[model samples]
Target: MRLRRARTIAAWALLIGSIIGWPVAAFGPARHEPQFVLGLSFLALIVESASLLTASQVHEETGSK
Candidate 1:
């Protein structure tokens, strides 16, 4: 798959996982398990998105060398 599509899918998965996982973590009776994945996934997703955005912008400016 293309990098763009892969990144988009990953971002969505992480976004949704984080969202769903947050509620589960809060209302379920767990202190660490669900929240761990939720927080980490969200953080990784944000970083991935930022990196992808930066790469795209760089490529745009650099003529996709």
Candidate 2:
């Protein structure tokens, strides 16, 4: 479990979770508020972006593609 790999996995998980969760929250029987769902999605995206940036930096420091 390298840091880069861990971050990459986390980023992917967040992205996929949001992709699936957004629709479920929007159109599913739960009927969550749109603002709440959008807030959560934005937060997930920000965290995912940070994780990816960190992973990229790690890869750059390690000189690995």
Candidate 3:
């Protein structure tokens, strides 16, 4: 039960973070602060990917084992 809840929270966080980070990348001085903007975008992508992967894992486990 606890693990399931944790996974749900993580998945939501990842999804939300990705949604929030895109605009910052789009309009936040991309050229002058390429590294920072790119880093945020990369992190957002990673989190989004991880969220999908973790969702599949949760589904496969089906709260069993």
Candidate 4:
């Protein structure tokens, strides 16, 4: 349950961060901070992949189709 909740939160954070980060990195005063946004995007990708692998493990453990 805890893992599930954390994954949900991470997903939402990634979505919201991208929504706000892109604009800030593109046209806002933080135009020079695009690398920060890109780095975060890469981190989020890694986290999401990990979450997928974890889910697969859980499913296999439970013998679920």
Q: Write the per-residue lDDT of candidate 1 for residues 1-65, one digit (tens) a residue.
A: 36655555665665566666656766676665667666686577667666655665555556535
lDDT of 2 by residue, 1-65 (tens): 37666666676676677667766666775565666867676577767767776776677567654
The pairs that clash in candidate 1 are none
Report clash pairs, candidate 3: none
Off by over 4 Å in 1: 1-33
- Residue 35 in candidate 4 has what lDDT? 70
Residue 49 shift from truth in candidate 2, angstroms: 4.3
Top model by lDDT, which number?
3
lDDT of 1 at 53: 56
RMSD of 3: 4.2
CA lDDT of each prediction against the hidden true structure: 0.61, 0.67, 0.69, 0.61
Q: Model 2, residue 39: displacement in angstroms? A: 8.2
Per-residue lDDT over 1-65 for candidate 4, one digit per residue giving the tens place of the 0 to 100 score: 55655665665666566666655656765667667766677567656756665665565556533
Give each prediction's root-mean-square deviation over alpha carbons. 5.1, 3.9, 4.2, 5.4
TM-score list, all predictions: 0.46, 0.52, 0.51, 0.44
Ranking by TM-score: 2, 3, 1, 4
Please write out the lDDT profile of model 3 over residues 1-65, one tens digit for every residue.
Answer: 76667666667676677767666665675646667757776776877767675775677478666
User: Candidate 4 has what TM-score?
Assistant: 0.44
**Error at 49, model 3, angstroms:** 4.1
Candidate 3: what lDDT?
Answer: 0.69
